[model samples]
Target: MTHHNDGVTTMPPTAAAAQAHRRTLLKAGLFGAASMAAGLRAPAVRAQAKRFAGVTINGAAFQHSFHAALKSWLPELEDKTGLKVNFELQSFPIYNQRMDLELSTHGSAYDFCNIGTPYAGRWITSGWMTQLDEFAHNANLTAADWEPGDFARGPLAILSDANGHIFGFPWVAGAIVMGIARSDLLEKAKLPIPATLDELVQTCLRTNAPGKTYAFVNDQLHHWEWPPYLMNEGGTIFRQPPTDLMPMLNTPQAIKAAEIYTQLLSSKCAPPGVLSYTDDQSQRMQLAGRANIRTASIDWLVPLAKLKDSKVRSTVRYAPLPKGPGGSFPGVNANGFGIPVGAKNKEAAWTFIQWALSKASFERMALQKAYVTVPRRSIIATPQFKEAMTINGQDVGQLYIDTVDAPGVSDYMKYRNMAVFPQVGEKINIAISQIISGQANAKTALDQAESAAIADIRKAGVKL
Candidate 1:
């Protein structure tokens, strides 16, 4: 409404002038009312679009595909939320060692970090990571569609405490599955994909050559690779993980698995430097057609068929890690982002995490980067995504889901969830190296490992 002023002069004031002043007062009153109404409808932070304008989130994590995909959208995150991010990516080992020191000292150098499954238990129990329940459930901070329930339960359980306090939002959840780089070798040998332990050994022997193309390859992290074999042989790491907490490394089952895994490496089925091959090296070996089979997460194996640089792209095939009489237990793990308890900018870091692990972001990373190990059921269940992950007539997406749904994954993974597992796991690796080098047989090596693990666990203050 507009007010018109009459051009008439009077002794005191004209009616038009009085009316104009009343109109101005009415407008002011209405404006205040509208402002209040808007405030009631929207969060204050939303009202101020640049609320965190000067905030900077210093994040630190290991170099991973999910982080690599996320960095591509850093500028977009800043523009959307007025938060600047200085994210540092390091190798897995370097990040773990440095983060351990930072957490132990309560340093606040990083606002957010990659909380891997193996370290999450120790970090969470130590109170190094911020409890994310407050931030995740905050209506004003978290969006309605953020859907904390969308995360796969198995992987999400890894990041949650007994009281159901979630510490991280997952980005990479992977299950160990077999990738055959030489279908031609299987075809020539006239054998189907190996489905049992005995068959795996036989298949490996049939396809293995003394030199040139190797029959099998595994990463240097034998603690991770060997556990499934142990479980398959009815062996276990603990008497009962998270309960008894006893070291069972010297059990008969463990010795059998150790013998089998060491045989794979020591019998010349794997490369000369199989004991030293990192995860990247193992993947490259299969991609270059130098390794006949590789058992790892879809994150690494899928690249053999999808990455343009792969020499085995046309010959690669996918299968679950071969099952055995004791039952198959493929390794499953997730890496997620969480705010450090010492972080000065916890809220801003949480904002970045929610955005990075948002459903939309998962889709974009999967579709755009061809990343296959996302732990969201909604995306993984979609027909388009299923189609996107299919390779060479193999439903690798379904294989991933099956691997996650495997019963042993949840029951057996509790062993790895113990805070002292890393130390004990290192002992397992050392013992395996001893067996491979002929310093000890399987039983002797594992007996030494159990002794060392008991000492380490007790030193870590675990009752057993």
Candidate 2:
């Protein structure tokens, strides 16, 4: 399978090879058998040797900083808990599917797992997760210190239940609505960098040179990308106050937004293959100088910088999502850590979560991976962290700092079936594609997508 620039590749691993990898990991643990055994059984291990032993958790294949932090922290945890902690990292899709299957069986395959905000509701309702309220209270971990409004009640709240029972701790926190552009290309166009959606679209149209360069591109199929545009137009997918499901796709504001997006393709402002462009494709286009603008997580900056001979290196720029009617609306994405309901070592797991999320640990992790942003408000404000952000070549650290301190947008998830948003998103993409290809009229495509979206929501058993 071809790998997209999204830093993810799908390589079909032979069953035998996979099993061998697992066996290899298991054998590696055996080298420290005495330590591992004592670590597994809490009381038998010595205090110094108890950091982390016999504890196993699973997380998706996150970026370097997170994985590197886990490598550093796991040993410390083993020493503290006298339990051996192991992490099984897999791709996001694989992890999501495996987690769902394991939860269905209430399997003990993992004591802890990293879950996204979207799946939090279903996981908690199904009794697959353990409540972390008591743990928080006991640890004297005040919500005030963590920017709960920005980090919790907003986006991260999707990982909590309706009654205020939190099932997870915020692991990775950052905005998902920043624009990345090739500075070299923008200079060549002699245009000021766009700080608003309108300016961005206009820039794309002005700079587009069909056979040479396209203006902007992205993975149009993902539902998450739509909200920034919606918010920019003073519209929302679902209105608050009972959170009624609004078919924003058919709204005039959405139609307008769709027109702008479709125009990029229809007017030749983007590459001909843009409809099939994934996130990685967007990244690659920007890196290769084939496109001028894209949206990406801050985690991508490091990898982009690492591309030594790339023309865009050191010349790439990032800023918050451009303003629209709502004026610079940005969306946030987060990874959450949760303990399984069936976990045999709840206390140990909680201890690790608490320790890992502490200010000191967060700082250490952020520095090791050169992470530009850390979820903890306190960590970001520190001088050391500011320096680290500078070293990472991020000019928007203050933006992230202010955003995390007072985040405007929140994380969102659809009803349990998950198919609701994606299905609707797909129809919308199809309509946009057709319009771009001149196969269908814009209004007709929007109308068809709106109808399909409402039907899908009903089929998913959502009340709205």
The runs of at least 3 residues in candidate 2 whose Cα sits more than 4 Å from the true structure, single-residue gaps closed, are: 1-65, 124-127, 140-155, 162-164, 241-243, 265-267, 301-310, 391-394, 411-439
lDDT tens readout by residue for model 1, 395-430: 889999878655445566777667888888898999
lDDT of 2 at 5: 94
Steric overlap count per candidate: 0, 27
Strongest candidate by TM-score: 1
lDDT (Cα) of model 2 = 0.64
Q: Please list the residue runs of candidate 1 whose C-alpha ends up more than 4 Å from where it truly belongs after superposition.
A: 1-48, 162-164, 405-408
Candidate closest to the true structure, highest lDDT:
1
